[model samples]
Target: MAETKTHRVTVAQRALLLSWAGVTDLGRRRETNQDAFLAEFPLFVVADGMGGHAGGEIASRSTVERLQAVVSAGDVNGPAIEKALEQAVGDIADHPETTDEGTGTTLTGVFFAITGDHAQWVALNIGDSRVYLLRDDRLVQVTTDHSVVQELITAGKLSPEEAEGHPYSNVITRAVGASELTAPDYVTIDVRAGDRFVICSDGLTKELTDYGIQHFLREHRDPGHSVDAMLAAALENGGRDNVTLIIVQVEDEDDSSSPIEDTTE
Candidate 1:
């Protein structure tokens, strides 16, 4: 199922409009769907659970449940997010069903906030899940994968094409649980009207290319439509893994002007 909601919030005393929708599906090959997400305002997240059976499901559920408390209390920042992850770590460790050494989940998404006097978008990531930004009719990936193939590509030892088919493509170097605590990489960007963000697990990318994602976003103006289209397409293309998606679009409540496209820092 897909859900859409609009939020009116203030950032640096400036009111902004934030709208988003999210969806998830168990692919053709997975016996258990071990993915979870939260698409609430100020925070939108997707987590692709790893390990096996109940392990992945518990890890993912614990993660979002912990983060959900943060959202309820309205303290969302790097440290706060880290604190939530710490709680999630504990949740996974205590779960009796999660015994696999590889049990964990990928957490990736963008959040809206006010830093100092300006409204900002903060993107965070761990593992192979991704975040992409669409502005000025161009879509660009905002998060880098922490996986074996990514390391090879960064070291100039593997081509992008070859990395796709490599046997180590699914091996992630970092995650939220699985017996280790790792910090997620965060990129802050200026908030702008007409800017859209796409957050998803590796399952979506495994089925759809960046170009395909861009095309679907262009084809749909509403968040709900965009999410449904992409989810359907991912499954049609052979959803080999559990797929998840979140579409977030920002707008200035006071103006209908075009979005400003600035490079993220």
Candidate 2:
């Protein structure tokens, strides 16, 4: 086993402060990691690609690269991210590797925006990948899935547990690069000290139940350790797909103004 790698980002703006870490694994089955992520401060993302061969890898990598480029150019709001995603869709469509049927990738994560004198957490999702919040030792899923199973669950045609093993569980109704334009769902969250957020692909959830996830999260306070534990648990349970996650913990700058930390295997 290799040592886990962790990247920390600490940002203090106005009355809000944030600290985040990210991790990704190819999992026990996949020969290639079709998951991509961006953990830069003010912007964090996880893209899970679909389509066999190298198509999935290209779709996810391109989506993240374009979004990162847009953020690096000083645009980090919902509209900016949306435009970046649309452009990514176009770029993927133009790629020769993409079939006429079109390859796709699920995008989900959070970005920070300044509202009044405080920074707000803007959560976004376009497919099955999800963003979750943990506060007061309780875990809450923030993003709704855009998959067939989720639609069935919402229509009351299927129960949550039944949807998990449904045949169409991986059939997403929305994805970046699946079409020329993709609209993502966005929500602004109130930020508070001790609020922890988790952004991950369906791979992790496929192997770990919500209760199991909550238990592991409640047991680990450090973002890096929590991420590693989650990934390890997923693999132990038979990693069926690529696993990726970003764990962000909010803290008051007045409580501690620590610099960013990085650790590698």
lDDT of 1 by residue, 7-103 (tens): 8765434466788999988999999899999988789999999887799889888999998999999878899999999989999988888888899
User: For candidate 2, what is the lDDT?
Assistant: 0.81
Candidate 1 error regions (>4 Å): 10-15, 253-265
Error of 1 at 151 (Å): 0.6
Poorest 10 consecutive residues by lDDT, candidate 2? 256-265
What overall lDDT goes with each candidate model?
0.88, 0.81
RMSD (CA, angstroms), candidate 1: 3.3
lDDT of 2 by residue, 1-265 (tens): 2233333333443234456678899999999999999988778899999876778888999899998897789768877888888878877877878774558899999987766545568899988999999877789999999988888888999999898778998888888875647788988887667788999999999998888888888888777788989999999999989999988887664653333221211
Best by TM-score: 1
